[model samples]
Target: MLKTLASYIQEYKVPSFKAMFYVTLEVIMEVLIPYLMSDLVDKGIANGNMNIILKTGLFMILASIFSLIAGALGGKYASIASCGFAKNLRKAEYKQIQDFSFSDIDLFSTGSLITRLTTDVTNIQNTYMAIIRACVRSPLMLIFALFMTFKINSKLAFVFVFAILFLSIVLYFVSTRVHPKFKKMFSKIDCMNSSVQENITGIRVVKSFVREDHEREKFSHTSDEVFSLQRKAEKLLILNSPAMQFSVYVSILLISWFGAHLIVSDSMTTGELLSMFTYTINILMSLMMLSMNIVMLTMSISSAQRIAQVINHKSTLTSPVNGATKIENGTIDFENVYFNYGHADEGYVLENFSVHIDSGSTLGVLGATGSSKSSFVQLIPRLYDVLSGSVKVAGKDVREYDLKTLRDNVAMVLQKNVLFSGTIKENMRWGNENATDEEIMEACRLAQADEFIQKMPDKYDTYIEQGGSNVSGGQRQRLCIARALLKKPKILILDDSTSAVDTKTDALIRNAFMEKIPDTTRIIISQRISSIQDADKILVIDDGKVLALGNHEELLKTCTQYKETYEAQQKGGDFDEQ
Candidate 1:
């Protein structure tokens, strides 16, 4: 955890060290003020000289002013350190999300990731501020006050030292026990975040099923568990205050007793005794500050460990060392490809599969839900690597070229189409950043999206709510297709993109693909037999294996599985149920 904090600080190492230096100087100055006040009481007041009293009083005031100035400077430095750390943390976490592969994303719950990025980061930031201020200043104050006490009377200083040792043992024990509990608290928080997020995202399903009470009860259970863990941790931490006060009270009593002995012996003057008592108060107060810092240290350590777990994760997928293929007029080829979602030694998803696709031709893939149709196309962009064999684009192995070069030439429209909050044109621009107004319109027309878009309140300028919630399912599908069309890549993939649209609109969109998007290779994955009936070539897949390969008529003649699927579709596809 300490190593992680250091790495986080290293993000702004130069500025952070500068801040530490300034804070140290401020703490030193702050400790000196009480000593100056002591001098004013012992030397100035005891002398019975008005000039000495006034001069020392003025000097004490100067010390206080200097202390305040140092404190302000320290605060300025601390702000720079903490905010800079937070900015670096956000950048690193965002990069991690982008680098994660499909499998990597599947390993963690989405709401847990959100909590780590948001709430976890906040906890670290708060703890960092405490470290820069109390963590540094409190120890310095306690040490300096001890030194001043010993300078006046070593015997009384021993009383102070005894109290500190006892407090240290107590703090060490409590902090050790609470460390594991703080970590557990954060885990519980992540679980609670997941419960709340799932409820909100699936609120519609809950309402439709009339399960509001069920959901509320489920969420309440998670919340209560988190609350219970938090209470347990806080119960231990609450011991800090009384323990600290008890130590301070004992030290004060010891000091008072020693001062009384000195005054009776005339070995210490009344004014000097008064000065010792004030310094003792300062020492005890610093110890109280130290106790609070110890608790914060525990919290920060737990948070740092969680953040480090994320930062240190190695992404399974990475760009090729040599770089990606430079694609032009996309041509895709699969050569005896073998793949598995598991490790290399595990069972394969696609075994010894081989196919070739030419430029300007469309290859339609028909499959059941587990048939690896989507997985096969995902290989073209190298979303995941094949365990054995190669995927080539434009006559070169994809691994030989950089990832960006390969993706730049390909556009994939996933089955689950989603839109972010933005105008219709803004979402389209995600496909082509420099796309012209004419190009967007042409792409929309090709997608059969222009008809309904024009019907919208602002046409191309229409606002799309988050997840395109304001639009119907079919309309969202069309806009997603339009967005991909705007890219104008060499290869276009529609992974059942037309599932929500009516058969007529789906046909129009397919016709536009044939008429307007010439010279671009297309791979369409769908379960609907009619959707792929007219393709130049078609592959029927079942249980991750290709059962047949041919045009619609050829498949009906040669393949029983293909024939049965086609007959079932003619009756009414499962998509109708959806």
Candidate 2:
């Protein structure tokens, strides 16, 4: 964990070094002023010399003014150093997440990843600032003040050293107990974040289904665990404070007792004793700062570990060494393919799933949930690698082509159609960055989205709510289709994407595809037989195995499962053509 944190710090080492330099200057100013003041009191005032008093007093005031200026400048530098590092870490984490494959995302929950990015990064930033301002200065203050103590009176300085050892032992025990609690506390934080995020994102469903009380109870339980752990951790660590204060008080009492004897014996001057006492207190105060800094550092280290776990995760899917730039057409072939997520020893989603999809061909897939309809098409772009088979696109293994090039040629409209909060045109442009107004209109027309979009006040430029909640389900699906059309991909996979559209609009969309993408490979997955009826080929899947493979009309004649599904829908009369 420390090594990972050290790497992040190394990125901003130059700025950190500069910030430390400023901190050192600031500490020097702080230490020098106290010594000057001590001199003015012990030497000048006690000597009854006006000139010495005036000169030393003026010097002390000047030192204080300089220290204030250094502090302000040093604080600014610390902010820049700490904030810049945090920003870089956040960006790095985001970029790493983008590079991670579906498996990586599956390993970590969305809520957990969010906490790691935001809360963990903030903890690190606060720790960095504390180190720059307090961590560096406190140690310097303790050392310099100890040196000054020895200079004033060695006997009193020995008293200060005893106090240091006592405090160190006390803090060691407190920190040991606190460290594990802090680790637990941070884990609780992750849990709390997860609970809150899930509840908030799904609150509408919770309310509609009357699960608000249940969700609230769940969130409260997680939150209570966090609060309990924090209290325990804080209560354990705070024992150090009263313990140190009591030890310091006893040491001061002893110092005064010893100083009185020395003064009476004429071994230590009263003025020298006073200065020594001042330096001893300064040392204790510095130790207090050091203790607090350690607490902050401990928290930061724990948080950094959580973040590094995410950043260091390597995705199994990687780009090719000598990769292709673009796929020619979209010819895809899965040769005796077998694939299982995670360990191959586990059950397979696709076992010996051999199929070939040629350029300009339309293949329809029918399956129950978890029968690998979506997973089958997902392989064309290598979303997950085949465990024991070769997946070739355009007559070459997918692994041989650049991942970006492979994914760019194959566009997928998933079952869950999502739209970001932006103008419709802006979301469509995500498919083709260079798409112009004319291309945008053409794609919208092809998806049958132009009619509803034009009904809006701003037409194609109308702003959409998050997830396109302002539009009906069918409209959202059409817009997603339009977005994919804008890309003009060589292959398009509609994974139950048209489930929400009416038959009329669905037919219009099918007609548009026939006219516009005459040469693009198309894979359609649907529960409805009518959706797959017009396809050149249809694959019936049941229990993770292909039950039949033929055109829709042929499947109805030969495959009992296909015939049953077709007859079931026909009995409902909803399969009637619009």
Clashes of each: 5, 0
Task: Pick the lDDT winner.
Answer: 2
User: Which stretches in model 2 have alpha-carbon errors above 4 Å?
Assistant: 1-14, 343-346, 575-578
For 241-324, candidate 1 gives per-residue lDDT tens digits of 888788778877877887899889987766666667777777777777888788887877777776776777777777878674
Candidate 2 lDDT at 475 equals: 88
Model 1 segments more than 4 A misplaced: 1-22, 343-346, 572-578
Worst 10 residues of 2 by lDDT: 569-578
**How many clashes (backbone atoms < 3 Å, residues ≥3 apart in a chain or on different chains) does model 1 have?**
5
On TM-score, the leading prediction is: 2
How much lDDT does each candidate structure score?
Answer: 0.80, 0.83
Per-model TM-score versus the true fold: 0.94, 0.96
lDDT measured at residue 475 in model 1 versus the true structure, 0 to 100? 87
Give model 2's TM-score versus the native structure: 0.96
